[model samples]
Structure formats: structure tokens, C-alpha cells
Target: MTGLLRAEWTKFRTVRGWVLGMVLAALIIVLLGVFTAANNYSSCEGPDGDDCPAVPLGPDGSAVNDRFSFAHQVLDGDGEVTVRVASLTGTITYPPPDHDKIVPGVVPWAKAGIMIKESVRQGSAYAAMMVTGGHGTRLQHNFDGDAAGSPGASWLRLTRAGDTITGAESADGVRWTTVGTVRLAGLPPIVRVGLFAASPCDLTVTQGDLGGTIGKCRLARAVAAFDHVSLAGNPWTHDDVGAMRGAPALSQGAFRESGDTFTVSGSGDIGPYGLEGGQPVERTLSGAYTGLIVVIVVAVMFITAEYRRGMIRTTLLASPRRGRVLVAKALVLGAVTFVTALIAALVAVPLCRRILRGNGNYLLPVSTATELRVVLGTAALLAVAAVLALAVGALFRRSAAAVITAITVIVLPHVLATASVLPVELSQWLLRLTPAAGFAIQQSVPEYPQVTGHYVPQMGYYPLPPWGGFGVLCGYAALALGLAVVQLRRRDA
Candidate 1:
């Protein structure tokens, strides 16, 4: 280890090209991270509030006791009672018994997930997913593969693994894979599970507008002796882990539904589109974080190019220990990228928090945990990328061609999908196979409607969960590293 460390250190120090690449990687990462984070939070993030004009008053000047229909309910004749969003405003004739104390309304605590079963024997909406809007209502995405207003087809489906529940899907089902493990949540838990989805599409969306209400979304059949259910994972967290902190609160806050004619105070939370002054729908910023990945590939090319120049051989000759040389390079790359990514995260997170503070209801209350997640996660991601680059570079001595090939393979197909050249059927399959699919981690959103054999298929927020996305990326990194090691052992310098 010591010899390897020395060799790596010497090799890295002597190579001005490597140093330049490191610096470049850091600069690009910082700029992109800060720019993207600030923009999203400033415009759309918010907390649910307790202001209602929808509740109707009674004939004797009393508040009506309406049964809770959706997620959030406004206080009427007083005591804590649930009501639909559309009913928030009206005449408060018969005020509730505890009306004074009910200053405003907020949603109660709840979580949503996808449940997989051996079979949807009853055919009761084969897969049921729970979704929450900006207003904090519980809704379900059942049997609808494509969400309303979405561009794609019925991109959702279920698959089975013998008697076990395995959610699966395909851009085209010919090549399907397991999304995640699913089952019930607690002791004597129900056989089926909850599904969740979110729509950033509504026009009236606001910080307070990005919630939903789920009246009663569930699965029909019992999941008997299931496996891999809880492990399905959340995908959106891959590219933007920080988004989780600003996610719509399931427990508190008033989620509003926005509109062109001001906002419908009584209506449920507006979707992401309804949020006031949010990123334009067309400019959703889908590619920013992915750019960082490209930069990593570029750096790898710079290093790998050295091998083609026979520079690596010279490097090894100078150092005398092949392993030491590799270790040194890895350390330098990891250290530099970690610091760079960390600084970017620190600057970007607070800037976003500050910008989002403009919204009165949705304050950016970041905790220590959120901060750690941002910094640590960024470093880890970059480190993995760097290691992969090292492996790739070492395996093929030519830098330019390898870099180009890597980038083309990793990023090109996703680009084609965007252009509509690739069908949804093919695209869904590609989503799992590509490195870009790993970006699902950055999502603050959770996917819903757990099904068998889908990519974290439980809901829209998934299709790929955070940790799972990371694991996928890690797997690629390990594979690339393993291949490089094999070549190193077999070939003569």
C-alpha cells in the first residue's frame, strides 16, 4: 500500500495535465451545482398553510361539519375535522366548537409507497399507487400507465417472479427487469402497498401549490411472503438530493392550488406547474447535473490519453510499482473532486435556501442531516466518477478515443430518447441500462403505484430511487475498475 501510494503520488505530481483536469472538473462542477440549486428553490419551494375561504357557513350562522374527503381540510365549526379542498371557502355561519384555536389548516402525517404482490388476482386496479399534491391530499395512480398530461404512453406495468412480487417494466417489455422489492409496511400489515406520484405540471402551482390529497388509494390482493419490496427506492434523489429538504411536507403546511385568476383558496394544492414564478415548463433544467458527469468523462480522457502516449509506462518506470501508481492517481483525483464538489454544494445549498425564503409559508429549514447529505453525496458521486475514469483510462492506453467512446455510450442514448428517435418501449429499457439512469437519486420526488418488474416502479418519484441509483452507479464503477485490473495483470507495460 505504501509503495503504491508513493508511486501514485509521484505520477500525479509530475503530470501537469492531470492537475489541470482536476481544476477544470472542480470549476465546472461548482458552477453547475450552484446555478441549478438556487434557481429551483427561489421560484417554487413552499410550505402548506392554514388559510381557507372555501368552508361554507350554516343557516344559523354556524360552521358545517364536513367529513374529510381529500388530504387537507380547513377548520369549520372548530374541532379538528377533515374536508375536501374545494370546500375551504364559503360562509362560516356555524363556526366550529374550537374555531378560535384553528388559526389555519395543514395536512396530517402520511407516507406513500408501491406494493408488489404475487398476483392482482381480483383485478382491482392491478397496481395502486398513492400520490400527494401540493395541497397535501392523498391520491392514487391506478391502472393509468401514463399520468394525465404527460407526453409518454402507459409507461407503467407490473411483472411477477414465480410466486413473489417483482415490479417490472420496459420502454418495450421485451427486456424487463425488477424495479425493487415490495411488501407491506408494518406488523400484520396489509398484503398490498401504497403508491405515490407528483405532478409538476399544474399551472397554478406554488411553494404551497405542490401537494396532493389521497382519499383512499390501495391494493386489492394480499402480498404473501414478498421480497425486495421496501428496497424499490426513490429515483429523483439521484441528481438533486438537496431537493428532498424542500419537498412538500406530508405532515404540516397549507398546500395551495395556484391559478391565472389569483389562486383558488379552497381548491387543493396546485401542481408544480401552478407554483408562482417557477421555472418555465419548457426549461425544466433536466440536463444540468448530468453535465457534471460529462466533465468527469473528459477528465478521464485526459488521463487515459497519457497511456496511449506511452506516458503511463514512463510513469510506472519512474515509480517501479504499478499498484502504487494507480493508488496515487486515485487519491489525487478523489481528493480534488471531493473538495471541489463539497464547496459547490455548500455554496449552492444556502443560496437556494435564501432565495426560497421569499415564500412566506415554505421556509427552507435545513437540518444538519440535509447539509451532510448534500456535501457528502456530492463528493461520493464525483469520487466514483473519477475512479471509473481511472479504470477506463488504465484499461485503454489511448485517451482521446476512450473518452469519446465512454461519453457516447453513457450519454448519447438518453439524448436520442429526448429527440423521440427512440420509442418509449425502447426508452424505458434503456433507462435502466444507462449510467444516466442513476441520476434518479437527486430527486426530491418519490415515484408511486408499485408494480411487479419495474425500475423502482412503485411511483413517479421512483422508477429509480436515491440509494438504488447510487448503487447502480457504484456497480458500474466497480465493473469498470475490475476490468481495468484484469487488463493490468495480463498485459505487459
Candidate 2:
């Protein structure tokens, strides 16, 4: 096996064209990545023509929206905050056919009720038991965790003991059921417990005349009236966490108090940042798609060229075992592709990200671990794709036919799915079943069912989870390799 591998590696390296082709693939990845980043720009000017503030980062280091209205009082230690949500109402701007008026309505996921937070700062640790406009009662914590309770429960409570917080909800305030319990690690001794309300922007997606999706987001706000506010402390203080500067007076966050009733009005969301107003880290790696094509061509030719020149007979005689010869070639091709692509990806990601930030674009923040996954995953994707192409080349023994077959299964599906030419459902299915599923490994932004947005392939959402999709592609490659092995063994050299 060692001798066979050495022979295959020697053959690949001695061929100047093959070595140059690998170099060209790496160059394409890095050059196109830098070009894409340099060309992309974003303008988020405030009402006064100044640059907008940076997006907030959650505790987990992902971009998050934490704007809301809070009517809170400081709690010294273990305590409980409870309130009855009387009603939830909101106004939508330019909804649908009439794009000229502000109408009274609540978008699904508008939230209001009681919360126990470490502080009033945006993206702070906290747990909230709230009633949403359409999702009913939910216990949400730290920008990502959510637990559903009884539907349409009007009363909510959050009790904090040490670092653990328990959320319970009730319909009449007499019969209560525990919604959820979460531990807010490192919560300070003094915390803010209060009544809060928030709503995300209203999203409208329509079909374009040319078989594409058109999406628009309009500003929206939610108002919730809470009665029987139960908390013991100083006079209630109101703050709009992460408030937008110079926003319209009607959309600004504020709270009104009358006796024991507190009415809070707020805008923005409290969850994962969806597909809007930011560029993901993977955006810088857009060149991977183009580089994969080059890799496919090179890998197919590596094997098919041997067949065309009638070198396979001599190669099989030298090895005596055809399967081992195929494996040796695949190993050499896969290793060279992986190493070249890895070097290109490592240079492209950070360099392009800096360029993106320099161009005034709000690059979505991701953790170091996630960024590493994206980079390594991209290299793996190219390597596996090359292996698949080699297997197809061995199966067909024709470079053009093999290259076409590999690209159609691996690249075309991704293009059609992400280009918005097909319906979202069909696009998702294509990503799921085809070798293009491997592209899911590059998705940095995740789909949160709690956040209301178009989770479509066109918007960078994949149907399968990252590793799951990669496994599908690997399965196809393995099957192809097995069939190629059988054909090589059965046919005369």
C-alpha cells in the first residue's frame, strides 16, 4: 500500500499541469474571496446622517437584537417578579396593499410580561416569562432558550433563587403551571426585575415577476398593559435597552404608569439576529463555489487522462490489484486538494472580514469556534467534492462526461437553490438530497423557529444541519467509489 501510494503521489507531482491546476484552484478561492469582500458595502446612516451604532453581541458571541422597554426595580437577592398582562396591541406600518398608512395590529411574536435580568444592558443575562401575541406563553432566557407553556396565559411570574430562575404562568392567576427553569450563571447579587415588552420588525415576502423572492421589512412596535405589578424596591425606573437614536416619536420606547398598572411600549427584538441588516462570516468565503469547479475539473482529469492515454494498463500491471490503485490515486488527489484549499481558506476568511468591516459593513459576529468550523469545513467540502469527482471519472473514464456529472449533482443544485429560481420548498429538498447538501457546512447563521423570518435557502438557511448535510454528500461519494471499484475489478485493463 505504501509503495502504491508513493507511486501515485510521484505520478501526480511529476505532472506539471496537474500541480498547476491545483495552484489555480487555490488562487481562484483567495482572489475571488477578496474581490467579493472589497466590492460589498453597507450604509446604515442614522437620521442625522451619522454612522449607526454597532450591533450588540450576545453572551455566546453571536449578533443579537436586545432592544425593548423595561419598567424595572432593583432586587437585592432572591425574589420574585410577577404581573398580569392585560392586553397586547401594536401598530404596523404600510402593511400590504396599502403602503401608505400605519394600521393597528400585532405581528406574531410580540412579547410582554415579567422578567428577571442581571441588568438593563443589551444582551445581558436574563430569563423572561412572557405572553406573545401569537405564540402564547413562553419562558425565554439569554437570547436563545425558549420553553412553551399554556396557550394564552395572561399572568406570569419569574422567581430567582441564587443563580437559578423559575418561570410559571397561569390563566386566572390562581392555577399556576411551571413553564421553565434556567440558571443564569454569574448573575450579580443585585439584579433588575421588571415588566417589559418588545416586538420585531414586520417582514413581508412576495414573489417577484421573474421567479424570485422580494422581501421588505417595516418598523413595528408593541404595547402591553400590565396590572398588579408585584415587586418591592425603589420607585420604578424606565429604560429603552439599545434604543435607536432619533427614531420617530411614535415608535420610540416608553413606559407609562398609573396606580399599580404599567403600560410598556417597545420596538426591536430579543433573540438571534435573523437574515437582515448584517453580513455573515461565510459571505467572505463565497469563492468556495467557484474554486470547487476548478477542483472538479482537475480531479476528473487526474484519472480520466490516464485512461485516455492508455496508461491504466501499465498502472494495473504494476499494482496487480486494481482496487488498491484506485484508492492510491484517490488518496493522493484528495490530500493535495485538501491542503491547497485549506491554505486558501485560512488566508481568505480573516483578510476578507477585515475588508468587509473597512467597507462599513456590519459583519455578523460569530464565536472563534464557529469561525474555525467554517474555515475547516470549507476545506473539507472541497476535498470531499474532489474525491467524488475522481470517483465519477473512474466510473466513466471520460473527463467531460465525468466533470459534467459531478458538477450537476454537487454545484448546480446549490446554484438553483440559492439563486431563488426554484420555490423554497423544492430548493430545500434539493439541498437535502443532492451532494450540494455539503454546502450546509458553511452556514454560520442558524434558523431559530422562535424568530419570525423567511428561513429559505436563498437567505442562507439550509434544510439539513451542517454535519448531516455533509454526511449525505459523503454517502454519495462512497457509493460512487464502490461502484468504480467493482467496474475496475471486473473489466479488462
Candidate 3:
């Protein structure tokens, strides 16, 4: 078995064309990655013209939107704030009929309720019991946490006991139902308890004439009127967390108090930042598609060349065992492809990231573990794709037909799903059923059910989780190899 593996490796390296093909594959990946990053430049005209404000990072180190209106006062220790939400409404800028007129409406995720926070800082830890525009009532905490509460409730309350915060909702402000409880580690003795309101931009997606998706985000704001506010604290101080200075007057956040009634209005969101206004690290690997083509052509020719030259009979006569010979060839090819791809990915990711930063583009932060998975997964993807191509070549014994079949199954599905105008559901189905499911390994951002955004292939969201989709591709490779083994045993070498 070891001798067979060594012989196969010798054959691969002894061929100058094959060795140069692998080198060209790696070079394509690196060059295209750098080119993609160099072309991505972003600029925002702020006080320091062409200077963009830094995005806020949440506790988990991911970029987040933390702009909202708050009417808060200091709380000494364990305390509670209760407020009755009289109404929740908002205006959407430039909806359908007249592209220039602002219409009155609230997006589904617009929220207004009572909140308890460690500080007035944008990414500070906090818990809230809120009423959403369409999702009824919810208990949300620490940015990413959410629990659904009684729907259609107008009353909200938040109580703090030590570091534990409990949220409850009521219909009549009398009988309260505890919605959820969460603990904020390292909560200071003094904190901010307040009433708040926030709304995200209204996103509208339409199909383009050319079979692509067109998404437009319009400005939206939510206003909430809070009456019968019950809390013991000093005078209320207004704050707009993460607000940009010198913004439009209408877009600015504000609050008003008339006796016991407080009305707060604000724009922006308090959740995970989507793909807008930023780039994901995987965006730099856009060249993987082209590089895979080079790999496929080389892998197909690797096996077919032996058959075309009538050398398979001599090689098999030495090995005698056909199955072991095929296995040895697969192992040699898979290992070579994996090492080549790993080196390319290791060079492309960081080099492209620096280019992206230099061009004033904000990168959505990812954890170290997730970043490692993306890099390793990319190498594994190319390696397994090579194995699949080799198996297909063994089955067909023709270079052109085998290469075209492998790419049609693997790469074409991805392009159609992501770049074409197919319906989102149909595109998702293609990813699930085809070998292109392996591309899910490159997705860095996850879909948050709590946040409303376009979760489509074009937005880098996949139907399956990372490893699960990779497993689907592996299954195809294994099945193809099995068929090739059976064919090799029955056919004349």
C-alpha cells in the first residue's frame, strides 16, 4: 500500500505540467483575493472629510448598531422601572407610490419599552422588556439574547436584584407575567434605568430585470408615548447612544416630557449589524471559484492521462489489486491539493484584510475560532472538490467530459444561486441538493432570527450550517469513489 502511494506521488511530481498547474492554482487564489480587496474602498464625509466613524463592537466583539433614544436616571442598587406604553408608531421614508414622500408606518422590528443598563455607553450590558411593531412582546438582553413574551402587551417592566435582571409584561399594568430573567456580570452598584425607543431601516427587496436581487434601505423612526412611569430616581437625562454629530434634524433622536407622559423618538437599531456598510472576511476569497476550475482541470487530466497513454495496464499489473491502486491515487491527489490550498488561503486572508482596512472599509469582526474554521474550511473545500473530480475522471476516462460534469455540479449551482435571479426558495433548494452546498463553509455571518434582514444567498446566508453543508459534498465524493472502484474491478485496464 505504501509503495503504491509513493509511486503515484512520483508520477504526479514528475509531470511538469501537473506541478505547474498546482502552482498556478495557488497563485490565482492569492492574486484574485488581493485584487478583490484592493477594489473595495469606502468613504464617509464626516467632520474630517473622507473620515468614517468607527463602528461600535458589542460584548461578543461583533459589529452592532446601538443608536436609540433613552430617558434615563441613575439607580443606586436593586431597583425596578415600570412604564405603560400608550402607543407605538413610526414613519417610513419614500415608500412605493411617490419615491420622494415620507409615509407613516413602522417596520416590523421597531421596538419601544423600558430598559435597565449598566451605563449610557453604546454597547453596555442591559436588559429590556419591549413591545415590537409586529413580534408582540419580547424580553431582550445583552445584544444577542431574546425571549418571546405575551403578545400585544402594552405594559413593560424591568427589575434588578443584585446582578440578575428580570423582565415582565402586563396587559393592564396590574397582573404582571414574568417574561424572562438574565444576569449581567460585573454590574456596578449604580446603573441606568430608563424608557427607550428604537427602529431599524425599512428594507425592500425587488427582483432586477437581469435575474438579480435589488435591495433598498430607507430611513425609518419609531415614536413611543409612555404614561404612568413609575420609578424612584433623580431627574431624567436624555441620551442618544451612538448618535452621529451634525446629522439631519429629522433624523436626530429626541425626547419630550409633558407632566407624566414621555414621548421618545429615535432612528437606527440595537442588534447585530448585517452586511450593509461593511464587509465580511470571506469576501476576500471570491477567487476560490476560479481557482477550483484550475484544480478540476488538473485532477481530471491526472487520471485520464494515464489511460490515454495506455500506461494503466502496466501500472495495474505491478499493483495487481485494483482497489488499493485507486485508493492510493486518491490519497496522493487529496493530500497534494489540501497542502497547496492551505498555503494559498493562509496568504490570501490576512493580506487581503490589510488591503480592505487601508481602503477605509469596515470589517465585521469575527471570533478567533470562527476565523480559523473559515480558513481551514476553504482548504478542505478545494481538497474534497479535487477528489470528486478525480473520481469522476476514473468513471468517464475522458478529460473534457469529466471536468465539465464536475464543475457543472459543483460551481454552476453556486453561481446560479448567488448571482442569478432565481427565487430565494429555489436557490436555497439548489444549495441543499447540489454539491455547491460546500460553499456554506465560507459564510462568516450567521442569521439572527430576532433581527429582520434579507437572509438570502446573495447576502452570504446559507440554508445549512457550515459543517453540515460540507458533509453533503463529502457524501457525494464518497459515492462517486465507490462507483469508480466497482467500475475499475469489472473493466479491462
lDDT of each structure?
0.39, 0.89, 0.88
Per-residue lDDT tens digits for candidate 1, residues 125-152, read: 2222222222222222222222221111
TM-score of 1: 0.48
lDDT of 1: 0.39
Q: After superposition, how far is residue 447 of candidate 3 from its true place, in Å?
A: 1.4
Worst 10 contiguous positions by lDDT, candidate 1: 217-226
How far in Å is the alpha carbon of 106 misplaced in model 2?
1.6
TM-score of 3: 0.95
RMSD of 1: 17.8
Tens-place lDDT per residue, model 2, 288-342, is 9999999999999999999999999999989888999998888888899989999
Each prediction's total of clashing residue pairs, residues at least 3 apart in sequence or on different chains, is 112, 0, 1
The best candidate by TM-score is 2
